[model samples]
Target: MKNIRIVITLMLTLSITISNAGTPKNDKIETPNDSLRLAELNDFWAEVSRTVSEGDFEGYKATYHEDAVVVFTTGENKGSVSIAKALRNWEQDFIDTKSGKTRNSVEFRFSQRVGDETTAHETGIFAFQSNNGTGNDNPKQFVHFNALLIKRAEAWLLVMEYQKSKATEEEWNVLE
Candidate 1:
């Protein structure tokens, strides 16, 4: 019985060692560079907001990867679409804002962010408000979103944008 117990303990120890060997040592270590990487991501989102607010269509377009995808859940629009198509649909708004026919702004608040040095998944809520120059009521619109980004050629570009659903002001405030 003593010999059997010794064998079992040794087996268990070996198994644990093997398992740990397969795991990356830095998996849970927070390196100083983590904050710097996150700051770069924050700047990426800030540029998105800035381009949209200023109606810089070309600049906004440059934020996306050439083959990016956009997913949405609006009525009659419940699937993934090419970023080019999405941009086409949204171009008129940018043009309107640029021509002074309207004013628009968007802001984002993050709930979670995960990524490595080359990739990122950002989950957040965005508030968009538009004024059509007319006296019509323009309420702020809030949305829950997840954006996947990749670092390419030292520039961060959005690869996939998932506009999940509508978000309330309360939900947006909680992230803050």
Candidate 2:
């Protein structure tokens, strides 16, 4: 019968289609080496953040490239440029921190890991909370942080950086 033949053909086609539908071809297979590298990068990032918040000037300088640059977006130090100047500022800060005149902590909102082992583009936002530690004053600052790091002889170093404050112009004007 013509109808029976048509039904048989339809069933054969359906079975063939179902049999060919397997796992996706694009499923990612992460290797053990990739996992280890990702973990290493994460640990390095955390150590870098910790050094700054703990007022470790030497540790902070060790984390950066020899010829690096820093830009400030907002604050009394707005439009700040020069890595050496930033280092000097941190050096002074470390001294003050010992006297309890200045203390701060940094909280990163995000740190996206991009690129390969030789180079990486990282970005995030952070809030730097500063206080007198004597309970005299308290203030918080938010900045958009960007950095480009390259592996320099096996260690990753930040070669380029940009930082823009999250505070509005009006807020800076009123506070400063």
| Per-residue lDDT of candidate 2, residues 2-101 (tens digit) | 9999999999999988886885666656667556655656666777778756777777788788888887765677674567777876787766665567
Best-fitting candidate, scored by TM-score? 1
lDDT (Cα atoms) of all candidates against the true structure: 0.91, 0.69
Highest lDDT: give the candidate number.
Answer: 1
**Worst lDDT window (10 residues) for model 1?**
25-34
Model 1: per-residue Cα lDDT at residue 109: 95
Candidate 1 lDDT over 13-109, as tens digits, reads 9999998998987567667677878889889889999988889999999999999999998446799999999999999999988988888999999
